[model samples]
Target: MHSQQQGWAEQQDALAEFGQFALSCIDLDLILQRACELVARGLQTPIAKIMQTIPESDELLIRAAVGLPRDIATTGVTKVPGGHGSAAGYTLVEGEPIVSHIPTETRFQVSEVVRRADVVVSANVVIGATGEAFGTLEVDSLAERTFTQADISFLQNYANLLAAALDRHKAHRERVANAEERSILLRELQHRTQNDLAIITSMLRMEARRAKRSETRRRLESVGHRVEALSLVYRRLYVTGVTDAVNLSAYLDELVKRRFLMHGLEHDDAVKLDLHLTPVEVDHSQAVAVGLIVNELVTNCLKYAFPLRQGTVTVTLERVEPGKARLTVADDGIGMPDDQVRGHGIGLELTPVLAKMASGDFTLEQRDAGTAGHLVFYIPDLRGGGSKPL
Candidate 1:
């Protein structure tokens, strides 16, 4: 009784260990091989095999084996004929457990693999899959021994565990495949959007060049700048492959570089960008809005602030509080000028609208020497598990 109880305890421990293995492993062959080792050791059988059903044939493939001859073990291409000829094949085809004691085992003809292994007793159990039999997990002993009801029960339960593991691994693979497909689609969409925006900006500039009115040209160029600002965010997103949030500091840094390149102001003698930006992350809407606002403010600075064409437009980002950030653009030139500070032009007039879109507000104040503008907006909880994140 004690021996039987000890065997039962070992089987239970094997099942628990197998559960952990199955959870972490997606490799089917490795899983089957491990299961063979466990079952063989648990049942005190020295030789074991896992043979899978061959499609539309009376044959089984030896997918994995332990404590068996090197020739009998699978190299991904070992097969045994089915239909009561071998224990593994019979169990797989019949979809049940079977035990054959060699002395009186007329139910099976000794196959070449088994014949060489010198098996005196064999126990085979079916490993199942979704709505069908997957294969057979069998154990063979060189010394004749009877597998008790409890022993057979342990084998059947282990087979059940294998069935569950196989299905779970299949599901995991499908999920990974689906995630990759989505990522590909996102990249394609971003590429097309960048191309579309490029065409739109080119057309606007072309129309501006042909216009008779200076105001008309300026307004068209302004619209093009806004579109260009929005487009840059998408371009950055495409390059980074980020789906949920955009890094604010990196985007702003790139924006300054872009502005310089667009108007041939990249030379050190021209208006330079003095960026002291702190890293922040926000959703798509805020990122786009923030980009546009920065472009407009900086454009106004370049258009009016510096008369000598040699000054710095300082852009700073600060985290004032949790879930809130402040972006400021300042210049030592002639100030924001005109009705821009009181909310007019593309920069000021749209400030309120854009700020609301970002779940925030905007303010402007003239310093002793230069003008400073601020847009305080919500920074998403990228860390999650909160209504808002710093």
Candidate 2:
């Protein structure tokens, strides 16, 4: 009874020491090393060791040890035997405490490791979130000494603590991996953007040099307007830290102002642009479509919407219903006949194909009082859902 009580007291003291050390602001490796040393001293044993299981090889490896050669203390790679296995292996397989008054002959251990030791017993405790066996708490004494139930229970609690630490280390590694992948993707996007910019710059140079008259030069300047619009989209995509939806209103305002400036149209010019648009969110595919459509419409308006001197162009865009939009490009200028309208711009034909691919409706209508074009189009939600008529 006295021995049992004394052992209990020692166990409590050891547990308290471990708790204090765990709470201390120390390195993780240092804390684990200290725990192994303390276990040997508290138990009055010749050897005390902590072993961790390697995931890939399914072998037990000693992480820290005391009262052994430096090389022996660091080595604990033990594989399961084809026949019967050691106490440590049995402890892990059965999830039960195993105690034996027998010597463990291991190829992983050197002769000098346990020369002064008589019987070396180990208590295996399952560690980690899924309760898989992680390692063992082993101790050896010069004389044969049976470990009590209380000793096994104390070691089990420590094993749980070690399991939590191992999980934290795993999580840290996953975060680092994710960060590296994101960096690689960002580099690839930048390379693609650079290539696209080079192509646009070449096209603008070629077009500018080929213009023969003031009217031709003014028409070619619209290409610069379109390129600047694309550049703005890319810039905002990077600046806002998003590759998704852009503020349509802001983009259009900036785009129109730049186009007017490129054609030498001052801010207080006779030409007035009235823009009325509802809020809309679009993915890259839709954004690209809308950008090209705007370029074509704006180019036509600048060329023939006004009598090169003065006029008003009202552009109204609205989401009439879910996945349905109505766009009207109207100008108080010389009206066009139905036959002339069909051959207005070749790009208008692509609108119907793109709309069909999106599972939407596309219609072109000519309004009276001006050469007005109404684009009634239904665009399916980029995310999901059926298309709606515009």
Candidate 3:
């Protein structure tokens, strides 16, 4: 009775050790090896092995083993027929534990690994999960031995642990593969969108060149620039392969550079840009709104801010406080007179509405140097599905 109790305690300890390791690990072969190692110690046996059924075949391969020859255990070429002949095959066929004296066994044949290792006794149980039989885990002893009912029960439970670990590892692998596939598809779609936007911008530029009146030409050209600005956002998304958020700092920098290139202006143009920006990450929805507002403010300044002499348009985006940010576009040129709209009035009028879309407010005033527009907004929470402005 005392020996039986001690054996049960050892089994419990073995299960606990293997269970913790299995839960935290994702490697199937490593789990199997550890399971074999633990069961042998739990049962006070000299050798243990785990055989896995070959896919769509009636053959069990020696997937992992302990206390066995290096050639037979690690080479993965040892195969046991999945029939009533060998101990592993019999347990797999009958879906039951086996206690056998292999030296004088008549009910089943002896496998080569066991025969060569001089194994005389073995205890085996089927490894299975939810009507799926995976394989068998067996503990073998070189000396003559008799396995009790407690030994059989412990082996069965240990095999069940192996089956559960295999299922979990398979699920994790599938999730990783699925995420990679989705990322690839998203990048391809974004690439196609960039191509289409470029085509549209080209068409708009053609129409602008064909216009007769200066005002009509300028309006068409502004439309083209707007499309080009939006294209930069998508281009960034495609390059980064991240659709959930946008790096606002990089996008704005690119936008400013494109504007400089569009007007055929050098670094020392009559209206130069002085950008004071900080890194900011916002969700896609917030990024689009901010991008449009910045484009409009900068375009207005370039067209109407520096009319008399050389001046600089300063653009700034800074995190003012937690959950709040400010974007300022100021110029050192002629200030607005009597709250008059600057560039065609459309951009300035739409500015307030765009700011609202981003959960922000827009304000324009005559500063000491030139007209300054301020957009102050609450950053969205982006953590744990809260609004994220992180």
Question: Could you estimate the TM-score for every candidate?
Answer: 0.88, 0.52, 0.88
Runs of candidate 2 with Cα error greater than 4 angstroms are 1-124, 128-195, 213-228, 336-340, 354-360, 375-390
Model 2: what TM-score?
Answer: 0.52
Q: Give per-residue lDDT, candidate 2, residue 385.
A: 24
For lDDT, candidate 1 versus 2, the one ahead is 1
After TM-score superposition, the amount by which residue 105's alpha carbon in candidate 1 deviates from its true location, in angstroms, is 3.5
lDDT of 2: 0.60
Residue 57 lDDT (model 1) = 88
Tens-digit lDDT track for model 1 on 280-355?
9888788888888888888888877888887788999989998889999888877866577766686678877888
Per-residue error for 260 in candidate 1, Å, reads 2.2
| TM-score of structure candidate 3 | 0.88
Candidate order by decreasing lDDT: 1, 3, 2
Query: Model 2 over residues 1-390: C-alpha lDDT tens digits?
Result: 997788677867876777677665246577667767767766767677666666765445666667765644454442332112444544555565555555654423322333433445544455543256556666666575667777767767666666665566556668778966875676468456746865785687577779778666654555565565666666655555445455554555666666666556775888777788776555545555566556556656666656655877677778877777776667776644454468544545555665554344555556555666555566545444221111
Q: Which tens-of-lDDT digit does each residue in 1-390 have in candidate 3?
A: 898889899999999999999999888878888998899999999899888888888778988888988865563677877777579888877777888888788887887777888898988888885247788898998897878887888888888888888888889999979987987888898899899999999998999899999999988888887788778888888877776777677788888877877766678777678898887777776787888888887787777676764788888999999989899988888866554555336667777778888889988878777888898988765565432232
RMSD of each: 3.4, 10.7, 3.1
